[model samples]
Target: MLVGTIMRKIKSRTWKKQRYFKLQDDCMTIWYKSKKLFPSLICVPLFPVSVSDVEAIREGHQSEVLLSIADEFPADRCFTLVFRGRRGNLDLVAESAEEAQSWIRGIRKLMENLENMGQRERLDQWIGDWFRKADKNNDGRMNFREHHARLFSFFQMADRSQSGTLEDDEFVLFYKMLTQREDVLRVFQQFSLDGQTLSQSDLEDFLRDGQLEGDNVQQHAETLIQRYEPSDTAKLLNAMTFDGFLMYLGSSEGSIFNPRWREIFQDMSQPLCHYFISSSHNTYLMEDQLRGQSSVEGYIRALSRGCRCVEVDCWDGANGEPIVYHGHTFTSRILFKDVVTAVGNYAFKVSEYPVILSMENHCSVEQQRVMARHLNQILGNKLLKSTLDGKAAVGLPSPEDLKGKILLKAKKLGGLEESFSGTADDSQTGEVSSGKSPPSYNLKDYSRLCLCVRLLVSYLNNIVFESPHSQKLTFISPVFLFPQKSKQRLSKELSDCVVYCKSVHFSNFKHSHIHSKFYEVASFTESKARRHLRDTGGEFVHHNCRQLTRVYPSGFRTDSSNFNPQEMWNAGCQIVALNFQTAGEGMDLNDGMFRQNGGCGYVLKPGFMREAEKTFDPETPQKRDGYQPVALTIQVISGQQLPKVNIKEDSIVDPLVRVEIYGVPLDQNRQETRYIDNNGFNPVWYDTLRFTVHAPELAMVRFVVEDYDKTSKNDFVGQYALPLRCMQQGYRHIHLLSKDGTSIPPSSLFVHIRITELE
Candidate 1:
C-alpha cells in the first residue's frame, strides 16, 4: 500500500550546509536542513512522506534487517521526516496524507488477516463476543452500525436525565479498554472509519449502505433507527386552559411564571378585567416582587384578584389645574389631561371604565379650574351632569363664560317675576295683562340649570377628585376656604350648591358655624344619610338637595395631638388636612379620619396648600431680629486713665451679628453693673448701660464708663469698659479692649439657629 515515492537530497547548495535523510520502506523522505549538528546520520526521509510511518520511525522502528547492521544506538538519538505539498490540497497536507494512508493500510491489513483466519464465521464469532459486552440490547455482533447506535443511545440517555453524556466512571472504563493495544486500536479505527466517533450523518450513511448492499446488516440498522428516532412513547404535554392556567398560577410551584403568566395570558385571551392596587408607601417592592414588571402592571394583576376601588392623590398645578399624585410632592408631573388620556386608553383597551375617581385636591382654585376643564373635555358631560338630559340642558360652555354667564342666568331667573310685574304696567291697553297670569315660570328647569352649573363648578374645582375613567378616585378636600376676599366670595356663592365638602380643619368651618348648618340645608334619604354619617362619621353626609354631594373630614393634626375625632365627626367634619412641615414623615391616615382615637377628622391647613405649590428647603436660615443700631469700638487701656473713647453710635448692624458690646468694666469681682460718669465737678450721674461685658469677678469695678452731653442728656459720646484688675494689688497692667468689646468670644457671636428653634 505504498502511496508515493520519496526523493532523497543529492549534492546541492542546501545539502552542503545541512544533511538530508531518506527511508524506502514507506517511500518517504526526511530532511534535516542542518546536521553539522548530526553528520553521522547517513540518510533521512524527505519529501512525499506519510506522517504515520514517519511517527513510527521516530518511535524507533527498527526492521530486523536494520537492527542486525547497527552496532550501538544512543538513547537520545532523534529522527524526523519532512513532507511538502500543494497549498490548497487537503490530501497532500502531511497530517491528512498520513491519516489517509494509515486508514487504507490498516483496513487492508485487517481484511487480509480476516481472510487468512479462514471463515467469515470466525470474524463473526469474535464480533459477537464484543457485541455481547458492548450492546445494551444484547445484539449478536459489533458492526459499525451497532456501535454507532450505542454511542447515540448514550447521548440520548444523558439528554433524558439532563446529565453529562460521558460520566467520569464510564470515561475511565472506555479509555482503559480502547487503548489496551494496537489490535484494539486497529479494530476501533476501522469501525470509526478513522474518525473519533460516528456523527448522525455517519450513522445514517452506514445504515443506508447496509440496506442497499445485502450485507446481513438488518439487526444493526434496526438498533440505529430505534435509538436515533423519537418513539411513540415520547410526546409533549397539552397546553393549559384558562381555568387550568389560573389553578396553576394559584399553586405555589405552578406560580413560577405567574408574573409574566397573567400578562401573557391577558395578551392572548384578552381578559375584560384589570385593577390597580395602591400601596401605602411608594415603594417599588410590589412591582419588584412581581419579577421586574411595571408597577401599574403589577397593580393591575393584583386588582384582577378582585378590586373595585383604587385611591390616588391629586395635585393642582400653577394654572389651578388638578392632577393626580400619590404623595406630598407630585411623583409624576404629568398633567391631569394626560392622566385622563391614559386612563381613557386603558379603559378602551380593557372595555371597562373606572367607576370612581378619589381625588385629593392639592391645587389652587385657578389650577383646579384648569384641570377640571381638561377633565370635563375628556370625560365629556358625564362628570358635570349625572343624567344626559341635564347635561344637554346645561350645555357645555367655555370656562371663561361659565362663572359670569351662569351667575347672571341665575340672578335673571330669580328676578324673572319681578321684572315682568314692573314692565307689565308699561304695556299699552290690554296686552293680556302681562303680570295678570301670575308670571308663569319653570322653576324645575331653572333648578336643573342651576344644579348643572353647580355640578360643573364642583367638577371643575375638583378635577383631581373625579376619575371618570376609573372608579378608583375618592375626592378628598379640606373644608377650609381661603381668607382672600375672592376665595371667600366664591365659597359663599357656592355654599348653597351640592358639592362634597370635607372639613379639613375645624377652624375652616368654625367661624361660619356651618357644620350644623350644612346638614339642615340639604335633604338625604334617611337610611342613606345615616349610613353615610355612620360610615364616614357624622362629618360625612350624602346630600340630594339641588345636586349630589358627599361631605368628608380633612385637616392637619397629629395622631397624638389633642384633638377629638368624635367631636369633629359629630360636628359634620369630613377631612383632616395635616401640614407637611408640622406632621412627622411616614404618617399615614390608615383608617380614614373617623378611625383614629383622637383624629378630629382630617387636619386642614391653608398654609400647606400654598406651600405645596412651591419647592422648599428647610435647611436655609431666615433673618430673625429686626434691624437695630450698632455702636463701633472704643478702645481703652487699663494703666492709662481710660484713654478717651471714640464710638460711632448709629451704624447698620449685620443681620447675623445682632448684639454689640459698647463698654466694659474694670472691676474683677464687685464690678459696676451700671455705667456712671461725672457731669459736674462734685456730682456723679447714673446712666443706663448699653454695652456688654466679658469681665471676671471684680471689686468696686468701674469698667463701664460713658460720656454724656451735659445740656441735653440725649446723646452718649463715648462708652468704655475698664478692667478692675489693673487697680488690684498684684495687677500692674491691663489689656486694652477693642472698640467692640470681645465679650462672649467672636466665634459664638454669629451663631445660626432655625426659626422654629428661635420661636
Candidate 2:
C-alpha cells in the first residue's frame, strides 16, 4: 500500500488531524504545525531490539534512568526506528523519527563506553549467547511464534491474550504497556500491533506501512488551555497577588477558609481602621464595645477592604437646630451647633476620614429650614476654610452652597438652592443675568412661587431628598406649585436644566411623562449644561434617571430608626431629620454626609464611633448627652363663679365651678379630705368622691355637680381634695373601667393634665 493510503487509513481510525510523512534514508518524519523530532538523538541502540529484550533490559537496570528518559522525551509524540548494522537488534521508540535517530547516537555512545571498559566485542558475543539459548529451533531467523513463546514465560502477567506469535507492533505495544502504562498510548499501541515480537526488517515494514495509531492529545490540550485562559477562575487567580490571596479567599468563598480568615483579611487590608458612631439617646457606646463595633468604621474598613456604603440619620430642632437623635421625643437636646462642634472635634481627633455621611430628616418644614440655616452657618465656614486653607472637612453645606463642596447630602428638598447657588448675592446676579429672579424666598409664601423655585433648588450637588413614601425624589428644577398649573412648565424647565442637575425629588412622578420629555429635549438646542451632571443626556444617564430620588409619603410620621440612607441618596438629599432613638444606635455612616440627630444624645457604643470613623474618614462624630427639656407651667385663672348644687334622694349632683389644673397630678384617693371655712359659715357639702371619678390611673382629675331635684331653686357647693401621684416613674397608660370591666373612653367631661417634669 502507498504510505499516503496507509496514513489516511490511520488518521480515519484514530480521530486525529491528518498528518503527512516524508521518508528519508535514515528515518521517517511526521509533520504537523510544528516539526518535532522523536527519540531525541539518544538511545538509538535500543532501536531494532526485540520488545521482550527491551523489557528485560529495563527490568534488570535502574528504573530511575528510564523515568528520567521518559521525562526528557515524553512518549506522546514519539516514533520508532530499526537499525540494520547493530550486533543485536534494537527497537527505538521516540516522539518522532528524528528523535529515533538521536537514540541511535545514544546507542553509539553506549557502545563506546563498553569499548572503553574493554568489553565492546563482548556486546556481539553476549547477544549470540542469548540467541543460541532462545533460538531452540535454530532456523537462523527466529520466527514470530518462537519469539512469542520464548518471551511469554518472562511476561506472563502482561500477556492477557494467548497469541502464539507477536508482531513488531505487538512487541512495541507490550514493551510500552509494561514501561509507561499510559492508557492513551497503550490504546494506540494495541491497535497498531499484528501478532509477533518484531525483528529489524519487520519493524521497518510496519513503519513504512503506517500501521501505528495517531493521537490528537497535543491539539486537545492546547485547545483546553485557550478556552479556560479567560475564565473567572483564571482571572481570579491572575489578579491575586501574594498579599491579595487571603482577601480573595475571604471574598470569594469565605466559608471555605478558617475563621481566622478575618484576621488574615485584616492583615491584608489593614484591619485597625476607625469609624464614628452617630449619636442617639439609646445608643450606649459601651454596648458597642460589647457588640464588636461594627459602625461606619467597620463598614469602611470592610469597604476600604471593600464595603459599599454606610448610613446615618438627622433631625431638625428648634431654631433650625438639626441634630442627630433617634426618638420621636428628643430625650437629649442637641443643637445643630453642638453636632458641628462634635464633628469638628472628631475630625481633629481622627486621621482617617469618612467617605460618606447619609442623613435622614425627621422634622417639619419650618423646623427643617431652621436646621438648614444652622447647618449652613457651621458647614459654610468649614467649606470656605477647606477651599482656602488647603485642609479637609466634610462640610454639611446648606442646599444653597453644595456646589462648592466635594461631598454634601440633601436629605430633603428643603435647602438645596442654598447649598448650590453659591450665595444669595451670586444667585441674584445669576437671576439678573438670566432675566429671572427667584421669587421672594419665604416659608409661608413658598407655595405661590413658580415651579422654577423648586427646580432650581433640586440642582444642588450631593443633595439628596429622602422620603418614607414610594415616590422617588429627583431634580425638579422648577417644581410646580400645583400639578395642574405648572406640570408642562416644569417639564420644559427640567429638559432645559437637566444637564445641570443631579437628581429630581418627587412623590410618584410619572414615568411616561419623563420619557416623553427626555425624547423631546434630546434634540433641544440650548445653552449646553455640564454633560457630567448626574441626571441627564445619554443612555447611561437615562437608565439611571428612571430611578426617582426623593419620595415623602403624605402621612409618614417622624421617628428615629426607620430613616433610610440609601433612600436619601436616591432622593438627592443631604440633610436628614432623625429622631434621637431610632437611627442613632446601630447605623453605619460612611458615604460622607453630616448627621444632626435633632436632639442631644450619645453613641451607644464608643467602639462603634471608632469603627465608623475608620470606615468613613473625616466624619464628625458627636455626642449630645447634655440636654434639658423645656418647662411649661399652668394655673387656675379664675375661682369666682361657685354655683348652687341641688341634691335629691338616690340621685347624683353635678359640682359647680370646676377647676382644671394644667401640668399637675391629682390625688384621687384623698377624695374625702376637706377644707374648713374661715368664718364658720354653714357647712358646705363637697362631693369629693364624684370629683375624683375620672380616668382611673391618669394624673387628671374632674369635678362635677349633678342637680337631682329637677328644681332650679336649691344650691349645692363645695371645696374638694386634690388628686396626685407623686411617685409615678414614667408615663403610664390610664384605664377607666366600668363596673363590668370594660374600659371607658375619653369624654367631654374629662380632666386635663400637662407635662410637669422636663428632663
Candidate 3:
C-alpha cells in the first residue's frame, strides 16, 4: 500500500491540521483520516479520493489557499490537487519534500493506469463503483433496500431463495432486469437467430441497416462483438448477448457526439478570421460588473476551459505598475503583471492554440510602458511582438501558424509601416508639457479619439454611467462634467506588440472595405451588431469573412448577463465574446459551439459563411445558394439515475426532458416531454421531438431536464448540448451535465436519433 505520511490538510490560512494519510492497496484511492480522539466512536472516519477525479497537480504554493500560508510552509513540501469541473482544490503540505514527491508521483501513476484502461475494464470499474455505493454497510454485498426502493420489485423477483440479500449470481439477474430496456430488447430479438444471441451475420445485418455502417460492416461487427461481449463464450462463438449490446450502446461509440470529432480534425490551416473563436468578455471579473472580485483565478479558469480570446481592462496602479479590473466600478483590482504571468502559464495547457489578449487600455503612457514590459518579460517568447514572417502584406495568420503564441488586440498609434520606420516616438510624455492645451491630430481621423485613453466620469446621485466600451464608472451624487483631457501618448513598446488584431473605430461596411487592413479588427456592442445584422446582414458577413469582428454584451447588462452568441455566429462574427463567469443558457450555447474539434477554441465557419464572394445572409437563409434543409427526429426514451435538486429526504422530483434547437432564426425551436411524477430514478417517456434545420451546418441541439412545477418556474436538473453535425445517428446516450456543465455520474438519457435530408 505504501501508506506513510503525516500531512497538514489546509482548508484555508487559519484552518490547517495534521492528518493521517494512506494510499489504498488498489492504488486508485487515497484515504485521509482525522486523528482527533473520540472515545465513543469505534474508528476514525476516513475520506477517500479517487485518483481519476484529479485533473492536475500543481507543485509548490500555487493555489490561493497555499499561497496564503506560504510564509509558514516551504514550497518544496507543498502541493495542490486540482479536481475536475467545479470541485474546489485540495492543498497539502507534507513533512518533507521527498514525501510530497512520493505522493504526487504515486497518484500520477495511478491516474495513468486509469487513463490507459480498456473499454471493458472501464465498464467493470463503473459497475464496481455502483456495487460499492450499494454496499452501504461495507459488507461487499447489497440487499434489496440498499439498492433503493425503485428496484425493490426486480430484486425480489431475482432472489428466488427468499433471501434478503442477493448473491453475485442473483445480483446479476437483478441488474439485468433493472437496466433492461424493452425497446432495445425488441431490436435484439429481431436481429438474433435463436432469439437469445446475435450471430455474426445477424450483427453484420444490424450494423449495416441500423447503424449505417458501410462496406466493412462484417469486420466492424466482429470487432465490436470481441470488444464489448462480457461472456468469453460469446467471443468464441462470434455472437453477442443483450448485455453486450446494452454496453456498446452506453459507450462512446454509441454517444450522440461523433467520436471522430473528439480530435483535432478540422482545417486549422485556414485564416483566423475564417473560424469562430471562443472569446470571453471582461474575463477578470468573477461576478457583476459594479461590484465584483478580480483575480488571476478568473483568468486561469477561462484559459483552462479553452478560451482563445480574453479581455483585459488595464488602468494605472500604485508604484508605477498597472492594474486590471472593471475600469471605474467597485470591482477589485489585480496587478497587470500577475494576470500576464497566469496567462503565460495556462495559455496552452488545455489546447495548444494561439490566445488573443483583448486589451482595453485606460492607463497613462508611463503605466502602459510598465504593462508592455510585463508582457515582454513575463510572457517572453510566447508574446507575438511582430507580424509572423513579416507577412502583414499577405493577411492574418492561421491558428496553426501561430500555435502557443499570444496576440495583443488593442488600439495602436500606427500600422506596421509606422512601427518599423522608427518615426513614432517611443517616449512621448502624455501631459502637454507643463499644462499646455492638447493639440488636435487630424479631426477627421477617428483613430486619435480611439487612441486617446478615456477618464471615467459619473454623476454624484449614486448613478453609474457606462463608458463607450461598456466599462461602468462610479462617482458621488452631484452631476459633474469631466472634460476631455490632453491626448494620452501611446507607448511605442506596447504599440509594437499589436502586430495583428489592432482595434479600430468601425464606421460602416464601405469605410472598412475601402480603408481598413486585414489585420485590423473592430468591436461592436450587442445592440449595434444586431442593428447591422438586421439592416446589412450580407455586408456584415462579408466584412467578417475578411476581418475579425468582436461583439460584446451591452453595457446595460451590469449584472454580467450574456446574450445568445449563436445569432452572432450565424452572421459570421468571428469573436462573439460572452461573460464567461456567468453561467446561463448563453454560456451553455457557447460551450456547445466550442465543444467540437477537440475544443481547440477555434471552429471553422460554415463554408457559406467563409466564402469570399458573400451570397448568404442569416436572415434570408432560404434564398441562399446551395441550401439544403434537414429533418431531425429525436426519441426521448428514458433517464437513468437522475439527481434530486431538493436535498430534502422525503422530497421527489417530477422530471421532464426538453429538446431545443439553436441555429438560424428560422430553425430555432423547442419541444418538451410530459413530466413523470415522483420518478427521478428511472423516468420513461417515449416522446418524439422533431426539428427542421434550415442551416444544418450552424445548428446546435440542446437536451435539458427540469423538475416540473405547475405553480412556479421549472427547476433545472441537468443539460447537454452539441453541434448537430457532430451528432451520431441511431441509438445513443446523452450524458446529462449539471447547471455548470459538469458531468453528473450515472445520470444520463438514452435516445434514438435520426437525421435525414429534406427535398
Candidate 4:
C-alpha cells in the first residue's frame, strides 16, 4: 500500500476536529487541514522514529486503531506519543482494526528500514534544527562570547582549582553526560595531548572539521578563538579557553540525545550484581494484581523499557497447552505459548543484553511437554538451554557474555538429598517444588537452577513447597510459617542455588549485613521502603552497596499506584520493581533512570555503591575532599504552549511554577514562583528561587508547573527533573513531561540558572 493511504489523528478532548495526519515512507506528518480553507494552521514532523518507540498498537474500546506511545505508559486511552526528543505527538484514532493493523505493520517495517539506513542524514537534520534554536544571531555557527553567555553557566560545578578548564576526570564526566559511548568519547579526547583535559582548541578542531589534523585544524581553532574567546584573555599555553569548551558542548553533536549514546559501547562485563537490572513484578497482569487481565503486552512493555527481568506464572489450561495468569484468581488468562512467542520476538529488539525469564511453574505433566515444545519452537536459539561457555563459571556470567540469551529462573523438583547435591530427583525433577505441577518436559533434562527464594512469592496463593498454599516450603506452616521476618536460616540446598537473587523480607537493615561475598536480595512494599528512606537510610545504603534489594508497591495499592523510585535509587537499592500498568511521578522517575546507557535496563552502580569494603552512610556521608555547598539561583521567566489545565472545561486556568531542591536535610527544600492568572497559553512568572545545597552530586532540582485551585488541590500540568551536577546554568529551556512520563512538546518553561559557592 502507498504511504499516507490511510492516515489519522485522534480527535482532541476539547476540540471537535483534530489536525490532519499523513504517513510517508520516512516520517509521519500532522497538519491542520481545515474545510474553510484559508490556510493550514499547523504542520509538524515526527521522524527518526523506529519500532522501539512504539509501546503498543491494538484495537481499543474507544478507537479501532489504538497506538499507545512506547514507554510513556499513559493512564487513559488518549495520551501523546513522546520519543527521540521530539515534541509533536498525537493520540490518534482510526476507522477500523484492519486499517490500524495495516498502519502499524507498515510503520514497523519503515522503522526496521530506518534502523538499517538514514541514521547519518537524520542526525544531520537534527543538528541543523538544534543549531537554529540555539543560534540567536541566525549565523551558521554559535559564538560563545555573547550568544553562549548562559550556555555553560554551570561551569563552577565541574571546574576545580578555578583553572577555567576542566581536567581529565571532569572532561570525562562532561562527555559521559552527553554520551556513554566509548568511541565518541575517544574521538573527543584525541584532540588533547596525554588526554589530561579538553581545551577550546581541541573542541574547535573536532567540531569545525570532525578531525584534529593538518594545518586546517589550527586554522579553525584560531578562527574560533578570534570569534568567541573572551575579549580579555590574550593567549593560553596549550588548553582550550573556556569559550571553546562550552561552545562545542552547545552544538548538536554534543546534545544529550546526539545518537552517540545510542551506540553499543557500554561495559557490560561487570558481574550481574554490579549493575541495577530493570525488573517488573506481575509482568503478565495489566491492572490490579488480584483480578487484572493477563496479556503478553505486559512482557512487551517491560522489555521495551529495558526491563531485563520479567515474571511469568505458568498454570494449567483447559486445553492441552499451558496458560499464564494469576492462579486461582478472577484474572483472565492468556496462552503460555503466546507469551513465550511475544518474548522471543521483542526480547532483544530494544537491547541486546541478556534477559531473565522468571517463571512460576504449575502446569500438569501432559501440558508440560506442550509448554516445552512451544518454548523450543518459538524461542529457538534465544533461550538459554545450558551455560553459555559450556562449563559453569564460578559466579554468574556477565551480561556481555550472555548477550542475546534468555535465562530461565524457576524452582526444580528435588528432595533434601538432591537439594544438597544441587541436582534434580527423578520425581518430576526440574519441576518446581510445588505439589503436582510438572515442570516443562524439555527442561526435565537440565539440572534445576538453584535459586534462593522466600517461602512464598505472594501471601495470598503463591506457590509453596509440597502444597501451593501452605505459605511455607515445609510440609506444614508451623516451624517456619511466619519465619521471624529475619533472614531465615536456610538449608545448604536452598542457599546454594541462589547465586543472584536471594529473596528475604526487609524488616530492617541492621541484621541484613554480610561479612562474606554473599548477596541477600530483600523485597518490601513501597511504604516500607519509604520508612527506611526516612528512618534507617544509612544502614540501607551500606547494605545495598554490597547486596541487592527489590522494592514493590504495597498490597493496599489495589489500583497499582507506584512510588517515586528515586527515593529507593538514592539508597543504592537495585531491582526496584514497578507495576508496569501504572503511570505517575513514580513511573516517570523509573523511566528516566533507565533511559540512559542505551536503555539496556542495566546501569553500573556509582563508585560509592561498588565499594564493598566501605560503609557509606546516606544521611551522614563523610564529606568528600574538595566538596562544598553550592549557592544556586534559578529564574523562572515564562512558559510556551502552557496547556490549559482542563481540556474539556472552558474556564481559563491560573498557572504557577514550583521549583524544588532535593538534597540534604530534606526539609525546607522547596521554593516556587507566584501564580500567573488567566494565562494558560503562556504564563509569565519571572520569579527567582534560591537555595543552599550541599554537594551537587547528592542533589537534584525538579521543576513543576501546576494550575492553581483554591477550593481543591492544585493539579499538575507537567514537570522536569535533573541532577544538580548535570544541570547547565544560564538561559535554558526545560522541557516538561506529563506525570506519566510522556514529553509535553512545544510546552516548555524558559529559565536562567547559576550555581556558585557561597563564599
List the global CA lDDT of all models. 0.26, 0.26, 0.83, 0.57
TM-score winner: 3
- Per-residue error for 663 in candidate 2, Å, reads 54
Per-residue alpha-carbon lDDT of candidate 2 for residues 1-759, written as tens digits (9 for 90 to 100) = 012111110111222222223222222222222113232322222212221122112111112222224444444323322221112212223345454445445444444543343111332343343334345564543334443332345344434454543333344344333323132222224333332222223323332332221345344223323332334443433321211221211121111112232221211111111111221212211112112211211221222211211223355555555555433322333444444433433332222322222334444445544544544566554322122233322222221232222122222121223334553232111110111223324433443453555555554322453444435445442333333321111111111111112223221223433432211111100111122122332222222232212222111232323343322222222222222212221132211111111101111112222221222111111121222222222211111112223232222233333333211122222222233221111113322232322222112222322222335542324222112221111111121122111112210111112323343
Tens digits of per-residue lDDT, candidate 4, 340-378, equal 877897799789888877666566556666776777678
User: What total of clashing residue pairs does each candidate reach?
Assistant: 81, 177, 4, 5
What's the TM-score of each model vs. the native? Answer: 0.21, 0.21, 0.87, 0.60
Residue 334, model 3: Cα distance from true site in angstroms: 1.8
- Give the Å shift of residue 690 in candidate 2: 72
After the best TM-score superposition of candidate 3, give how far the Cα of residue 267 lies from its true spot, in angstroms. 1.3
Q: How many clashing pairs does model 2 include?
A: 177
lDDT of 1 by residue, 1-759 (tens): 233222222222222122333333422222332345355543433333333222112112112212222343321221222111101111111223444345335434544553344222332333333334344443332333333332444444433334433333443333223322332223223434434443334433443441122344455434443433333231121122222222211222121111222221211111111111111211111221112211232122212212212233445554545554433321334445554443333322221222223343345435544644555567553332221132212221222222111111000111122222554223211111011111112334434555666676667656745656644423332111222222111111211111221112122212323333221222122243345444532123111111112222221211212122222222222221211111111111112211111211112211211121322111110211221222112122111122223333222111111112211111112222222342111112112222322321111122322333346432322122221111211101222222222111001100111111111
**Global lDDT of model 1:** 0.26
Off by over 4 Å in 1: 1-308, 326-332, 351-354, 381-384, 388-759
Query: Using alpha carbons, what is the TM-score of model 2?
Result: 0.21
For residue 76, model 2's alpha carbon misses the true position, in angstroms, by: 78
For candidate 4, which ten residues in a row score worst on lDDT?
A: 444-453
**Which parts of model 3 have CA positions greater than 4 angstroms off?**
1-4, 11-16, 20-53, 68-72, 113-148, 158-176, 420-486
Q: Is candidate 1 or candidate 4 better by TM-score?
A: 4
